[model samples]
Target: MDVALVLIGLVGGVITALSPCILPVLPVIFLSGADRERRPYPVVAGLVLSFSLLTLLGAALLAALPLPPGTIRWAGLVALVLLGIGLIVPRFEAILEAPFARLPQARAGRDRGGFVLGLVLGTVYVPCAGPVLAAITIAGATGDIGAGTIALTAGFAVGTGLTLMVFALAGRAVSQRVAAFRRRQRAIRVASGVAVVLLALGLTFGVNVPNYATALDHEFQRLLPAHVPTGSDVPPALAECVGQALYTEPPDESQDCGPAPALTGITDWVGTPVTLAGLRGKVVLVDFWTFDCINCRHVIPHVEDWYAKYHAQGLEVIGVHTPEYSFEHEIAGVRRAVAREGITYPVAVDNDYGTWQAYGVQAWPSLFLVDAMGQVRHVAVGEGGYDETENLIRELLTTP
Candidate 1:
């Protein structure tokens, strides 16, 4: 799954480079090779490194901090505008370069200068945020600074860098062959600079890039294979009968795990409560979910199906809605989301996390299968484990 996600990021980066918004900046790749005397690798390396680092940092900050969506967009736009001005007017470059004048001017000064220029261009040339990029950003926003996130970001940067390197090499060949290109280099720079400025303006003024990106992303997702597991293979223990040991190693019956915690601190209840003692004869599946969580949303259909299939057979599904964002705390928001998602099952809004902490929940979309005796018999986190979870549910439902 991580590999697939990384591949998606790589493909997304390639697609983004080919998009209309990025076309203007494609020409900027030639700048690295303009001075054939200096090697282009330093500039290329700088661009890739800067872009990747900045992307990771941006994602981390967005996830950790509650920043307005428009803030980053506006800042990027301003930076691009200033860069465009610097490119079109050589005089402006002097003003911009003043801050970095203290650096030593040795034999590698030109290479260092090229690197700095590439860094600036890389930072300013943000592609339209497509689904893959959005996923990476969301992971970052959710405080998931794991290897998967890093891999995705690195894959994207590499894809963009590979494309840019090709363009740079091709431009270098053209510059060497065509005297006209060399003679009119300034004109090309000004034209590309103007194009970048226009692109930035379009983003700042809302050109509906997100809508287009979403449509494109959906089309791409359709091409990929389904990653989630289905409950086609159920274990014999869960499939056969109730009152049977659900696991090879049974839980310590004498431990006295206590009655299931009351559904406390719930801001809204979608249906009647299914308390531990009240539902003693029935099996219960407690789901920790948030409306906005993608993983949680993915498992909803399966959960709903289980409720529909087994509700009449002494099976109960309870959703504990624990919010990750502040906006989700509002009862109206959760209600609207529930309606939008067509969730008919009973849902308890854990606004204060009373239930979350009681269960020692750590992630969204966690499931706990409680037997008819009101003891937690099974647990699963994140996505997948469909067969195991549903089997446990069946076993509990069948227990006398």
Candidate 2:
């Protein structure tokens, strides 16, 4: 295993925990073990195990398995629903905890079946990662798993697990501290149960409340590193390998990635249809995103700002709306998202993922800056490159 990549992955995972992409799942992670008697370690352990394995093998496994579309997601929702019910009903909760009652380790990790709860959450958990996770997902789906991939995946899981541990512990602390809450464990359990059920239902229906926690995410991105800074001691080849994935560097415009791929197989359009070829002689920002992704939601405002600020000056931002969930495939949802976000730029819905594959999109909230000459100038994957992207846009607009 390449230790450097693992380190990079570790860092990537920590930042992702702080990113807007994980915002939606933070509450679930926080409340997973909020009960005074439940331990957070086992839940986190289960979460890490599930996320790492699934990130590496989930796509290929899902495609190869005979299960119907969205089966795993549905099953996960059902599991959470049952777990929630177990919390709201004491007899059911006792029945659920009966199996883990005697085993010591289970007592610790599966206290109130926390491990199982984590496992269910992990199946549905979608956290945005730079090239670290994208590479793992591709490697997993394409059967190209290797030591480096495995190490990076492991490191990312560990980093994310660390943060999740903090949230879980915090929840436990808060639950124990307030005498009012401590005295009413049943009520606390009911509240936690209701949260779990709501989360499950939201995922079941692709219901997402955008702009949920932007300020917190802003602080995270503002303070954390987004990519490996320039002139690090890392090997040049290694840096280039993960360049598409970003590591937290001060943006440099000297990058020459390649030409932008043709935008194809877009089944619908929210504002209008646009092609890379037709968009020539213009500074184009192609944002690959889905409506339901939290990170994408966070990134949209910046895209809107840029489009509003630069559209008159030869800037064209095309939101290539891709689907991560089954419901995002519908145009009606896309329209609502666009309107809600107050986005006036064109949106291309690539339901078939043809455009996604065309650009080798590794994550939602990915952006490619194309110069008027129709050459790809810059790529920002997984949020947090606004200053650099904006500066580059200015340079491109003024230069050509």
Candidate 3:
């Protein structure tokens, strides 16, 4: 269903929406009532709507604008640092004293002024929540279009609104339990401060970089043969080097396939072993994949079609699930991913990456073609090679 792009968008949205920065400021909206009389709904609604709309714009800009990939991350980081510095000195006196702090007072609880009110409040709220919002917007820029931006905006609004609703309804309940709220507030402030700093760190160091999937895709594209049977006439040294850098290693006759490592399963999840040895005498193809990787999802259809066509002719496909994220380690999540993807082949959980390391695989959706003798013959990392892979399978199955 072309879920990769959508999922990326959804995740980007949710990440920004659920940020700690947005959560704490929601109380301010209700508290601005001075004497606190049923905290006006329009104010809260307007704030969420405006923030969501702003994020949507940010996402659209990200999609339309031709900016460097990491620019958003850096911007988000800087914004966060500035936010943290402001929070450390929350007094207006300190801000007013600064040479550049000539910002005027924001009209506190006026929500009935229509679009201008929404725009003004949203703009003013930026100083309070800008760091996190910027980070989310920056993240949206990593995708192809407004998908990431819209998803993040929607997710943020939902998350923030959900919490605000709870707080709004239970404001009196919360007020009575001021001690608990204060404790929670303290924890929240600490978390917000930490999140901003972490964002800065991630931007500075390029953490969770988006190169893994694209890098693998490019690697696969490079291996396409110029002519059938006779691959590229490129020098062996360059090919070997490229292969080593992309995959785990190049096929070497003298190099042992190594002692087959003991496959480790995810904790608390028990599943039967689906190994190449179990399907011996059949043309076996093992796909080393992770659920979170975008490039891996792109080539699933080709693999599925190839497996269906060749299965009756002594062909066996096994999926080795080596997760890249902590959440992917969950057996239920893995099962869900497998089901949603409509994967019929036997899947082995390589949560510890034992199989990945054994085969020297470094990329998701890496394919290893094993001949009937269980010898590794062809390795394709990241997609393509449908015809080549099919021919190889047909050759192995038909040989004897």
Candidate 4:
């Protein structure tokens, strides 16, 4: 990887540590090395290893598997809750510690316990790394799993690990100097546990801490004279056909279901004004998306690829820019987003939700495939199902 990319990853990792997503986990780092009898290096090593592996594997799995992001998020939430409960209740901690006790290293000093705790922490800690991490994950999703990608991901993990170790070692020193602090460690643990539970509740209720952190980062950068790159310049069209399994399985043929909805109440059109009637003789793919949504952004590359690949083969791809947030309703904002995202297909601005209501669209990044006869053939919501949608399109084009 280039030095610039590595540096970006390192900086991104440090920013992630400072983000609110990592706030709850800070106590864990502090406590990991709070016991002077325990060595922090083992815990730090475990954290680095687990986090780096998970980051790399998770990105690849997201690209290769039809795993729902919601499912993963919920699972992580559950883990956090359990950890928080364990921290608060002594009996619960003993119960949770049983599994770790089975490890051979558990017989050693508290260092082994620290290592095991680090492993669990690594699995559950979901820090928001903003644009740099976004670019890396995008590259992974687009099948850019090269040495450079691995190096960048590793560099991010290293940065995080190093910062955590610093906190842990400092905690160890403080514990050694202050005998009273060591005596009151249990109370501190309980407080930390409560904080973690509150954080979990916040995340469950859709409090986007990462976005807030990103905004702070932006403001901080503005104060500096030198322009700081947030990795937003990463290409928007880097997606390739990683595999078909990332989405749902394809249908054998396009089913002539019902009439397609018309594009109505469009304030502006990006490429050309497209009507269902006008696209009767062509295979059409309608994509519903908003600019601010991460899920929508991730799906854009695949949508763009489909357009580039099949536009010449009688496939008409139209993006319906549906507004999720209030800012997305502004035409200038939507236009700038379109330009930044490299969306060149016909985009009908659904400012009034007229088109959205007509199509009965309920989610961002929804897709509907229409046959040559203006019949809705296939549909997908959220992310994935690229292969199935593409297959349906190909089937419709070949038919008649």
Candidate 5:
């Protein structure tokens, strides 16, 4: 068990807990803390236990079982619905507690409820890929779930649990002592329950709440990827850069990976159909991304910022919108996400992974920096490298 990988995973998990990626499930986490009498320990513990197990063995388990895709996630949502109902109606809550009524510490308010909820929540909590997490995912995706991978997964699970545990504890303390919460305990409890149920419903219906924590997430990604050096060609400065790079050479002002792949097989076009040949003589930054991807969400804000600042200066940013899931392939969904993100640039919908495969994109939110000559100049995967990417764009735009 490499301790460094464990630490790297731990740090990445902590940052994820603080990232906008965690926004979707925050209501449930808060509710876990909202009950003043409930022990949040069991909830966090079960979350760690469940997450670690799922990360390491979920794919294999799914393959062996005849379960459909996302069965566990749906089960978690169902569990949340039940938990919310339990909170809203005290009778249901009593019934939920009935199974443990004869056990010792039956008077214990939290006893087993929180742990059960955590188990369910863990199944629903799908984390975005960061540097360390990408490795774990590759390991899982490739059927190489070894002991070392298990250790790293456990570290991430425990670290994520710790950050969330702090939030839950804080919520519980506030509920216990805060004047507003104390004044309307029952009403507040009911309101919190409603929020949880509504969140689950929203998730079930595929309604994505907009994220405001992108900038924070962007910063948090910087602290990840501190594992032991693998004698790769990554420069000392970029030693902590996101993931395994397609380019092992040092960053060059004139870095060209060869002529860029043509944008083809697009399902639909958002705004207008703009091709690479038409966009010649302009420095183009082709963003290979999907709407539902959390990393893509974080990356878009920065891309939007650049487009706004540099469009007139001859920077043409084209977003090749690829679908990571079935829902993301919908044109309406793509339009909604684009409008929601305030994206003004043209987005090409690549539902068939046509452009994705053409460019050999391995991850969501990949940036292919194309020079004015229509050649690929630089590439960035996952998150971070905001300043570096921006600087590269500046250099490319200014260069002949």
Candidate 6:
């Protein structure tokens, strides 16, 4: 383990143990407990185990096991949907009633310790970190079970634990105010149930909203300078697509979007297909990225915005998710990535780096611009070329 990474894990753990979002749930878990002293410990343990289990599951998914992203997302969405339906529909209320109603017969007054508590808490407590945690876990599911999984699990546990510990400290206050908050609790339960349903529905269908991404891509173009260089140095036919900019020099060998790789598979979340060949009549910008890449995280918002603005104008934006880790392979993680980032364009997953190698991509955010003739145009290695790229896209879209 890298000593620095381990230290980072420890810090993440401590902070998670103290976060505000998770702290409030501790009291509820305690109140759900039949025993008093055993309250916080069990809940805390459950929450910890949940994080550990989910993290481990994530690591496993990254291994590219047969499990597909749609399956997991659908399963989780089903669970949340069922829970929500139980809350909203009186006829379906029996589902929620079963847990509370069967509590007496199920436990037989037996006390649940840390592990059991942890399981229950994890099962019930829906942390705001769901999407991020789910993405990490999905990534972990890809490669390296030994050190990578352990480190990721440890980091996740610490992050969640740090937020939960504060709840442990406030458990007593939470217990005392139970009665005064009963009405509020009921309302919360209803809201939570609805939220789960809504989230599931969004995951199932609403993942295609494209407003944010379109806006950001536009901002990138608008930021360009007034004058763009172009002339005899540039191809007469391709000059318009270059937007008055000359081919300053050959594209960097490292930034080259290697020969277009064979299309092994395609999963369309937005049903938009802007292939390398399809863009032969216009300019194309291919974004090589993964949902979990911290750098890609910042760039996606802009990518989405750019796609919406320039796509109709003949700029084809194809986001290739060449995941760096295993968890990124999960379709659910990809779907969440698209939804969370508000990406409306088409994305292809290169979990195996089949496409990554095809493009010879080596960075989180490598952009490849292909001219109207289908040859590589310009390439940007890292961040901070939004305006230049957008100008190129605009020029390409406007070309005859």
Off by over 4 Å in 6: 9-44, 58-139, 167-179, 182-283, 288-305, 311-314, 321-346, 351-353, 356-400
How does residue 393 of candidate 2 score in lDDT? 92
Per-model TM against the reference: 0.48, 0.73, 0.41, 0.51, 0.68, 0.50
lDDT of 2 by residue, 1-400 (tens): 7777677677667866766556556776776656765677777787788877877877667667776545666687798888878868878877877777777663553354878778877877766534456567656655677787788788888889998888888887887777886788777778777877887887766564544443443344334334323223433432343354443443567366666678878899988777889988999998988776777877898999999998998999999987665435568778988998899999998877777766666566778888988877777766566898899999999994
1 or 2, greater by TM-score: 2
Off by over 4 Å in 4: 1-4, 35-46, 62-67, 106-110, 208-400
lDDT of 1 by residue, 1-400 (tens): 3787577567767656655435546555665465454345665667778667656665456545676533454565676677668668868855766676777744344455556666655655555434355445445444546777787787788777777787778777887888876787777667656755775675444342211233343345445442211112323332221112111222323222335555666766876755667778788888888765555666788899998989999888889987654345667767776786778888898866667656645445667777788766666555555777777677667667
Q: Which structure among the candidates has the greatest TM-score?
A: 2
User: Which one wins by TM-score: 1 or 3?
Assistant: 1
Task: State residue 201's C-alpha deviation in candidate 1, in Å.
Answer: 2.0
What is the model-wide C-alpha lDDT for candidate 6?
0.51
- Which is the leading candidate under lDDT? 2
lDDT of 1 at 374: 78
Off by over 4 Å in 2: 20-34, 66-69, 94-112, 173-182, 201-258, 261-274, 305-314, 321-364, 381-400
lDDT tens digits, residues 63-137, model 4? 466664334445656766776786688688667667767677744635665566566566556655344554454
Clashing residue pair totals per candidate (backbone < 3 A): 1, 8, 3, 1, 0, 42
Write model 5 residue lDDT over 73-169, tens digit each, in one string.
6777898888778878878977887786666653465657777767877776656655456456545534567767777787787689899999888
> Per-prediction RMSD in angstroms?
11.9, 5.8, 17.5, 15.7, 6.1, 11.3
- Per-residue error for 321 in candidate 6, Å, reads 4.7
lDDT (10s digit) by residue, model 6, range 240-275:
323322112223222223344333445443446556
